[model samples]
Target: MSTTALSKPWTITRLGWLFQPISDRGHEEAMVLSVYRDHGVIPKDSRTDNFNRTPENLSNYQLVQPGDLVVNRMKAWQGSLGISEHQGIVSPDYEVLRPTAPEYDRRFLHSLLRSRALIDQYALRSTGIRPSQWRLYWDEMKTIEISLPAAKQQRAIADYLDRETARIDTLIEEQQRLIEMLRERRQAVIDESFSTLGDPSVQLRRYIKFLTSGSRGWGDYYADQGERFLRIGNLPRANLEIRGDIQFVDLPADVTEGSRTMLQEGDLLFSITAYLGSVAVIKGDWVGAYVSQHVALCRLERDRVDPRFIGWFMLTTTGQDQLNEGAAGGTKMQLALDDIRGLRVPTASIEQQRRIAAHLDRQTAKIDALVAETERFIEYARERRVALITAAVTGQIDLREMA
Candidate 1:
């Protein structure tokens, strides 16, 4: 990290990428020239809209030069700003700004565009408009003031940030790959357990006790209301992860009337409808509201079944087959209360079950640890990339001097 100050009185302006006049093309024919999301441009091929233009339309549409500061006027608040280095055409909705002054570093302009001040301006200006469609009018956006850094200093900071952020990105990618591998190994563990059990003498229903779904007249609540809510959307696919589909809700008094519905350690949560059969286990002390209508809370009778074993089984082929078969409904399949009650499972003695679960847990934990370390490295790389850019632009580190 470098402690460098930028030159004073930095000027700011909106770079309208859509400088060229619209061609003789219909809105539908106007191929999506460019798409920006999360501080990066969406690849031309991955574009879901028809805003990006091919070379055919490039001549008629406005152009974006390399290193120009461009922003998706509509989504600037969501960080849809980037340095346009690719030879690509963007939607007419975008405003591209090329630095008018030689003293202004293009890289410095880009960083400043993404700074807190600019983003806040976009947010405040967005008042009452649909957040997704709020556009930054260049006339209004260009007047936004900024503290300027010396041209040389600006270049240095930009260079520093680029190098450091690249390192962080590499680390994150490695961690993601390792996490995938760990999950695969964990899946194998589950598969092996089922295969090794051979023929079970005990009947599935006799040894296992599956909780039936209760009444389904629960009302809804907002996530921002300060309640910890779990929905079926939170459950990950077998051998996958839980990432942000589910929302939190404030706990309502009526839902927690009895202790039976309260979520606890070792309980398996299953989706009943919508995204049918996705599952996750409550591993530790989790304080949250009761399940939504789309989910079923399963509690295993300890005397008959091991909670960990049941969770593992659900991850295997056998469990999935049962889940699919038991699922009802056409478009959105659902597993009925009776179907879950009737599903078969392999049960073992408490000692055997404990041994198997512990073994798998240790192996998975080791893999998770490796992934976490790689992720930390990725964070360091990201910070370094930003710092490098900042250093180059601020003149704390001179790239020209090194050359």
Candidate 2:
């Protein structure tokens, strides 16, 4: 709570005094609603990304009406509660609350209750031995005291936030669209770079020297200061670069796979497991590193076919299509060493291959930089939105006109 009083008068009261919990259950016929930390409450069927499967029987679901506060007990501290605008049914584990008096504005409560400060309060009040088990049930939630201005001033604050956030959201949407466009353009650049060379009929097996997938027994060679151990995550999806966090493992002299899978400079790496076709070329300091079983080590005939040129081609659409078609599939899809060897590539001079690789390297670097920058901008916009809401709800801003 702020020590300084605002220009408008405010009243401090417990949440229980303002809102009452209603336990009306078994609304299986109603539409399902879900509470998201970022999106608040929305129809469950509207999003495809949520991994949690809804139960076939909705017998225990609770009925919810418009303007009622729906709290996902397990995630309330994470700002996953919201004043619902749709009539639906939420899980019985959630708390359904409605204003006891008309003095409260749903819009005002939406912003205030979900603000960072209030979420911190919710976290402090939540009970659990583990974070995953943390829950904010109604008994503890009702005791939290908050200061509220008159209903009119509350409306003014809510209106201000709604207007400001919409503008920020617009900019964020534009930035996201730009990022998608840039990615498509990046892929097009790769496809176009390889398009000039005639049909890829040359069997990749003709130029390859030795091929083997990494062996298991990963935990046996665990160490902090030793050779780099590259996992499936190290393979980049966009280009032929080995990226992401590195894990170093000390290799035992007796370990047979360590010598067998030791990566060499100019060596081409392919994802032989579930990831399928992501490829990277080892360079400089990464030469002595070993790979996990999921990655395939392909020591190419560098004289006949440039390693980087082949690596870049593996990222192109045509390359990805061949790998997907040839990979063995059932529950899990994966590529065999022979499948990689069987891949076809455009037969070209080593000089032309180097030129193609160079062109893609430059083009992709520019696109990746732009995508990173745009993502940062979106992040900043989200931070600003949260800050604005917190300021409004905490009475840090004066809304004397609405008083």
Instruction: Compare the candidates by lDDT and give the number of the best one.
Output: 2
Candidate 1 per-residue lDDT, tens place, 1-403, comes to 3344433444443333222222232334333446465445444666556453465544444455565556777777776777665645565566666555545666666775665556777777654358866777666665555555556656665665666666667677777787788677767767787787864344345544556443454345555655445666677775333435445556467755434566766766777886655777775424444566677777777765777776667668777777887874466578766676677777677888878767766766676677677667767766665555444443454344422
Give the best candidate by TM-score.
Answer: 2
C-alpha TM-score for every candidate: 0.68, 0.93
Error of 2 at 162 (Å): 1.3
Clashes of 1: 51
Candidate 2 per-residue C-alpha lDDT over 104-198 given as tens digits, one digit per residue, 9 for 90 to 100 = 88889889899998899899999999889999988999999998888888988889788989999999999999999999999899989989897
Q: What is the C-alpha lDDT of each candidate?
A: 0.61, 0.87
- List candidate 1 stretches off by more than 4 Å: 1-31, 47-69, 86-93, 96-112, 115-135, 146-165, 198-210, 220-230, 233-267, 274-277, 280-289, 299-301, 317-329, 338-344, 394-403
lDDT of 1: 0.61
TM-score of 1: 0.68
